[model samples]
Target: MATDAVKKYLEDTNRPYSCADVTVNLRGAFTKSAIQKALDALSEAGKIKCKLYGKQKVYAAIQHDNADGPSENEDYDTPIKTTTIELEELNTQLKTKEASLKSLLAAPTSDSARVQAGEIKTNIEKLESRLATLRDSVEVMSADEKRGILESHAKLLSEYKKRKRICSEMIEAMLEGYPKSKKNFLEELCIETDEMVDFKLVSFQV
Candidate 1:
């Protein structure tokens, strides 16, 4: 007749907790005939509380406040309490709230209001287009004036090609003077600096 065995039976609602639930968990010293006797003993000891729901009489364990204290039903501010909320009631509330939220979000805004909003967006986009065009014209004019002032800035690739040509001529002259034959330039350049082809990899940008 352990209090702990009765406590386990009352806590889990999914399992069909009964006298069998107690006896099976206890394993020893608890026989089928003794199941009723255990419940009676726990009830008489005031270590259990029960509530009626539908056809089932659900029991819960009561915690003892103090050894010297009177039973939990005494005039103490804090007494042992157990709450069993009805599943049906909770389910009904959940469905009602779900329906209400669905209705609220699904309801359409006023037709006139939506049209006005679209018109306002169109006006904003038109203004932004004009602003962008004006900005582009200003940048082009500024670039032309700067180009006129600084003709010193030359194309970097033009100077690089000229230098490469001069180097090649000098290298050919030196190699021609050597008695040994020069290595093939075509095979080395083809393998080392081949042109890049189209390819893609995973990337993200702002």
Candidate 2:
């Protein structure tokens, strides 16, 4: 019964779906394992199509007449294009905001601007004191020790950037057919980007 239901769903939709997607769309009519088995049987019987994209397997109904139709991967690629454009727009906005912030900090004409400037000054004094304490507690290092530290920092930074990139791509893919904008989704999840925190990853000179 699940096999028939899944087969009919795929044929009617004529779109690719992952196992998790099928399970969610089915409204829990069948267990995920049962749905997966149905998908696999249909794929093996040539009633449906299955392809591995990255680590995930996606299935679609075989179309006989629509040979010139869009590829299944287009569903994933379309979101990526939209997300890229949105990111570019957001970057432009960020630059404008940064310039405005610099102007406010330099002038401090309004009450809010003056308060913010004062807070920033306090933060700077605290950071300077912390840095002095740290410097006093640390001993001078040899050239070899300094080089090793720099090499370790570089390796960690590379891994961090790689992981962040992978995560961003995955999120972009997941944004397909999502109801809300990427900014709203991230806000709901309380996720912060590097730009939000004014953080940047830079290579350490060894």
Per-candidate Cα lDDT values, in order, are 0.57, 0.85
What value does the lDDT take at residue 102 in candidate 1? 97
- Where does model 2 exceed 4 Å of error? 65-206
Whole-model lDDT for model 2 versus the true structure? Answer: 0.85
Deviation in angstroms for 66 in model 2? 5.7
Best by TM-score: 2
Each candidate's TM vs. the true structure? Answer: 0.27, 0.35
Cand. 2 TM to true fold: 0.35
For candidate 1, write residues 106-160 as lDDT tens digits. 8766986799889999999999999899887845557666675444334444575
| Candidate 1: stretches off by over 4 Å | 1-89, 92-132, 135-139, 142-157, 167-206
Local error of candidate 1 at residue 124 (angstroms):
4.0
For every candidate, C-alpha RMSD to the true structure in Å: 17.4, 35.6
What value of lDDT does candidate 1 attain over all alpha carbons? 0.57
